[model samples]
Target: TVIDGVTNTTTTVTAGTNPNAIAVNPVTNKVYVANLNSNDVTVIDGTTNATTTVTAGTLPYAIAVNPVTNKVYVANFGSNNVTVIDGATNTTTTVAAGTSPVAIAVNPVTNKVYVANQISNNVTVIDGVTNTPTIVTVGTSPYAIAVNPVTNKVYVANQLSYNVTVIDVASNTTTTVTTGKRHNAIAVHPVTNKVYVTNQNSTNVTVIDGVTNTPTIVTTGKSPYAIAVNPVTNKVYVANYFSDNVTTVIDGVTNTTTTVTAGTNPNAIAVNPVTNKVYVANSGSDNVTVISPSIDTALPLTTAVTSSSLVNVAGISNATVSSAPAFTFTATSTYAPTAPAIRTVYYQVDSASGPWIQASGAGPFTATLPAQSKGDHVLYAFAVDGLEGGATAGSSGEGSGNSPMVGSVAAFAFSVIDPLAQIITFGANPGPVNYSPSGTFTVSATGGASGNAVSFTSTTTGVCTISGTTVTMVTAGTCTIAANQAGNTDFTAAAQVTQSITINPILPCTPGNFSATGNAPCTPAPAGSFVPTAGATAAIACAIGSYQPNSGSISCTLASVGFFVPLTASTSQTPCPLGSTTLITGASACLNLPLLNIDNSDPATVYDANTDAVLLTRYLLGYRNADLIANARGTGANLRDAAQIETHLSTYIPTNQALSPFDVDGDGVVLPMTDGLMILRRLLNPNALNVMTAAEQSAITANAKRGSLTDAQVLQRIEALKP
Candidate 1:
């Protein structure tokens, strides 16, 4: 239930079953009500009166909101956990707590949540950033919780243990405080650094000294269930459940009490410190009682600018706003309200019966009037109590309200001058501009109110000049560019924006662009792009068949053989896939693998098997000279020793290739101990190679499989390579 303070009106919104606890985020104007039976929370939008239901843990008994993080925490008694609700997204994250988490409070300044666990006799301290929980042991059956954000302390009221536990959030250490019996509620006066605990089972309230942590009893009406304090007035209101319609109001400074009449069973209480109004929720009477100090019927005072009224025709003594006529005015003679409520000043143009609109918040307020048409304009300025559309306070943001006017309306009969409406801004900050290459760059101007084309003019006499939208540098000095747009019949001429573009006299090579080999200009393009322009350069992507991996390249490098360039501006090469080949230098794609002639023996291309295998054995055993040609079948067997054999093997396996026929085991590497041995065995005795014994395979040493395939994989590849 929400109430209007000014009209004494009540608005009730629906929530889930057994709504037991309520919390509000004043910054977002969102109200959160925890429903114990429904195991959910109902979020009410203060502006629209709409409701959104969010699921919480079982039996959400207590709730608190941290306005800074826009998060709400609900202490679930049945689930032994707390459900945190994101106010912006309405999402929930359940954080584990101690047993029977009954009550919760938040220190918004520290972004920490404190939940009092009744069964576990501890308090769960939840860090808002990580939503992580840390348990701090407290008195037995800790029930109610309160936080002192200013001092970073948490106070818990223990029902069964009959004491208050103050936890210093910085240290996570506890200070036991002796207080009244069966503490049901606790409140902290941050400015005073004092703590107050209400004993529901007794006729007194416990006051704990802030510095000493010592408890003092302040007598109150019987059975106080809930309590509230007004930091502004230093007055505390205690809701005595069984006090028979009497609420004890204690002066915080004097520690004295005054009994005020209220509805039966004043169980919940709140205070509007700014208004000095106390509101009590009397559960037994089914009504809320509003308590306020006496207010005298003194009309609010107001005044407007002193001026010789302009005639609307051609006659004018001065501008409505004077002395070069700027738009600004303090809402003078508008303050020092006799009533205690916060006040706002409102204004209406040309109409007295129309809705009053607030121009500023709390004074000293200033109002910026909008551009008005030509006419004798009378601006009605007055003040009202509270926020601008707020029944108690006027609405805040140029808000609309029809509340009764507080003071004398000030009327200024002034001609409405279509203000210099055009506001022009440079597309970029013209702080410093370079002068090289074409000695020119395009300038842009926007935000012309009359939709007129903006023109540029060079303000500097000789250093620089402008033609159309382009600014050409004449020399190295300050180049001031002024942009302007002529107003139409409706608007006045726009104020031009003059920007001085500095071109240094002694130009040192700027960062990013370095000097060439002998102190000349060097504008290097970024990697994968080249051919940079003089000013604000954006080089195009490297052409196909070429790449520029480093900055400031004169040209892109052509792709070499064994690699292909498929994409534009490719900084790296791509290898052909398995069983594919490309012989063309600077090729963009790979072709199907050619039918390889492995012989290279006496018959050149013909593999009769025996002679070709023997020649390869000679090449493998590091044989050189005539030994490489001994019994070789082909005169084309130029391969001998390591480098020549490596070159021959590379022809079949392109750069970065993963697989090749020469790598018989296809383990992506050719090792003498494994691949070479297997190849020789296959050529010498193809029939017995598949059944090689484990002892023989042990010769495939560690380096053979270091970053390649395993021995089992090598064996599988050997099987696949078999005839």
Candidate 2:
């Protein structure tokens, strides 16, 4: 039945029942209809309306065809299977899939099969090689699948989930993208990779970004069921099932929709990308309507060169041309709808020049040069289709002709060269190299064209050395270097100069001690066990008598609270200063003392022994003793020196209280011993000190002697003070 243009009567097909999917084979000119209720495929010869039923899948619903493979895929809804029919022999191969297969699509590039399983909520991926199925989970109730050849992205529409699941072919990862309500149909613009999904309930379309997986909503007529794209113009056509009209156009690039009037129940759609024409299956009208996508593309001037026909004077394939010349050729294809067939295109000019011709191949074709006597030539090649009408030619015919075609092209340029230096020059420079620790460092200059003879030289010895382009330095000094090209270098390019390199060295701390009053600058004596040499003992003895400063300029008052004294041969080093009141908690003390002033005179003495009180408090409060010492000494900071000062001065008592016994060996653990002989043995021989046990060592170390007393003399006093 057919719809009358003048009357309002609705026509329908004879009771073939539940015709769900429809497709046409342009080669055989046959129309295939998948009948869900009949469990078979309805084949209608395109030239004649007569139809024949072939038993195929159970509850067959959707159908797709591979032009190259010449096979038709049918979705078996009831048996969860697909029927692959050989068009030539009409034989079938059944492949198992998910619970309920509803729709199917074929990938032109890989010739793989994809079936949407509605009940399983996934799509079954079929390997064309092994004919095995891999079920890939999609959104709920996947109703349709479409593949974009250019981007190799597969889009599946889920009616119940209201979303589309995109499958990346390379990674096989699934990303769910929200779409219009009840998405039922999907199609992809091959060139743009823009996917269009038809919403059955919300009466809208969803535009998807193939690369970013982003979705843009587009409104369409009510109840859109299927969609198709014209690859030639990147336009889309959607079939609206309930609106009784078709959304005639979609601009893939802009994602715009436009509706056009059509017969009732427009259910299925397909596009011939080559001709830019769309075919919509009107279920109610039981007929297919064709619409052309308006194309506006620029055509190259040299369209005649093609893949199969390029040749030289001897007609040998793979010919070379010396110069650009105007030549032409014919293009033809044996496939029906011959326009979509891939044809080879070739030229021998920088930008689309030389004798152009078409060959029979996929894409990326080899060119045959036209016979010519030339000086120079540039060749460019690509693949195109002739969906629009064009003339056919014999094997040995001239390619000078016209064909309306659109496809991809890649133009390559190769120049004839003589033996000459191919110079590549680059500016070279070195990064900063000022490192810690005094040592030699070599930094070779980087950057400059390849094959340039580079030589380097330095201005300082041992600090840096240069051999060829490499520079090495082993000294702790700064030096500059230059890299120059050899005389026989290919080209005269400017040389590179390097920045200076510097190295730092480690330093040792000077030793001394001081006694100051009123928080004076009394350099605390080096604390802990000290083994003074003969020379050091002599210096200490002289300084002790004359009350003079030591070599480190350390001075102290005779009766100040703080002590600064060096060790002599007969005196043990007094580790702690004289103190008065509070008991020490652990080894640390909080002694409230005033700052003392230092006398920078002949002896440079500080009457008050608290010379460093203010600085010590400031250092402890700021928690930056190292920084303070670096500033005072006008040199790099030393942590070891700060540790030494802290060890000796960290423990103190109030200077105003009654003087207590400073015992060097009669601490509580020494058990009431006041023998001077034992005290001297513990002080003089460290082996005896070690043999005294930990308790004995603690007893001797705890002794505190102040005022003009040496370490050994303090030990004797400690023996006298013992309990």
* Best candidate (score: TM-score): 1
Candidate 2 segments whose C-alpha is farther than 4 A from its true place = 1-18, 24-31, 43-53, 273-276, 283-723
Query: After best superposition, candidate 2 residue 694: deviation in angstroms?
Result: 99
Candidate 1 structure quality by residue, lDDT tens digits, 226-283: 8898665567889888875445468787788888888888888888764568888899
**For model 1, the run of ten residues with the poorest summed lDDT:** 321-330
RMSD to true structure for each model, in Å: 24.0, 27.8
Residue 695 of model 1 has an lDDT of 50
lDDT by residue for model 2 (155-189), tens: 99998989999888779888999988887778776
Error of 1 at 156 (Å): 1.0
* Local error of candidate 1 at residue 235 (angstroms): 0.1
Cα miss at 292, model 1 (Å)? Answer: 1.2
In model 1, where do residues sit more than 4 Å from their true spots? 295-723
